[model samples]
Target: MDTVIVSSQYQIVIPQEIRESMGIVSGQKIQMIAYRNRIELIPLKPIAQMRGFLKGIETEVVREGDRV
Candidate 1:
C-alpha cells in the first residue's frame, strides 16, 4: 500500500504511480466517501464512457412458472 502525508491544509496529493494507473487527471472530479473508519475516493465517469462496460455478461436466470 502507498502511504501519503496530509499537508497542513488537510489536503493530500495522490501518488503519481497510482494516478497514472487509474487514469486520474487534473481537474477531474472524484467523490469522497467516509465508510466505516476509512475514506474512499470514487471517480465520476461520464455516461458515454460507461457504455458497454457489461457487454457479454451472463443473462440467464431461474424463474418460477408463474413469473415466467
Candidate 2:
C-alpha cells in the first residue's frame, strides 16, 4: 500500500503512479466517503462516458412469478 502525508492544510496529493493508472486527470471530480474509520474516493465520470459500462453482465436471475 502507498502512504501519503497530509499537509498542514489537511490536504494530501494523490501519488503520480496511482493517478496515471486510474486515469485521474486534473480537475476531475472525485466523491469522498467517510465509512467507519476509513476514507474512500470514487472517480466520477460523465454520463456519456458511463455508457455501456454494464454491458454483457449476467441477467438471468430467477425471480418470483409475481415479481415481474
Candidate 3:
C-alpha cells in the first residue's frame, strides 16, 4: 500500500507505480462515483475506444405507464 499526502488545496498526486501500472497518462479523464462510504474512480477513454459498442443495439429502457 502507498501513502499519499493531500496538499493544502486538497489535491494529491497519484503514485507513480499505480499510474504506470494502470497506464494513466496525462490529460486522461476520470469519473468519480460515490457509493455509501467509498468512492470510486473510473477512467474514461477516448471515443475511439468505444467503437463498435452499440451496433444494432436498442438504446432505450422500456417503462410501463399507469402503474398502480
Candidate whose lDDT is highest: 2
Per-model clash counts, in order, read 0, 0, 0
- Report the lDDT of model 2 for residue 41: 95
lDDT of 3 at 34: 100
Using all chains and alpha carbons, the TM-scores for the candidates as numbered come to 0.85, 0.81, 0.65
Name the regions of candidate 1 deviating beyond 4 angstroms. none
Model 2, position 3: C-alpha lDDT score = 99
- 1-68 per-residue lDDT for model 2 (tens digits): 79999999999999999999999999999999999999999989989999999999999999999998
Position 51, candidate 1: lDDT: 100
TM-score of 2: 0.81
Which residue pairs collide in model 2, if any? none
lDDT of 1 by residue, 1-68 (tens): 99999999999999999999989999988999999999999878888999999999999999998995
User: Top TM-score: which candidate number?
Assistant: 1
- Model 3 misplacement above 4 A: 52-68
Q: Please list the C-alpha lDDT of all candidates, in the order they appear.
A: 0.93, 0.95, 0.86
- Tens-digit per-residue lDDT, 1-68, candidate 3: 88889899998788999988888898899888999997677888889989998899988777779753
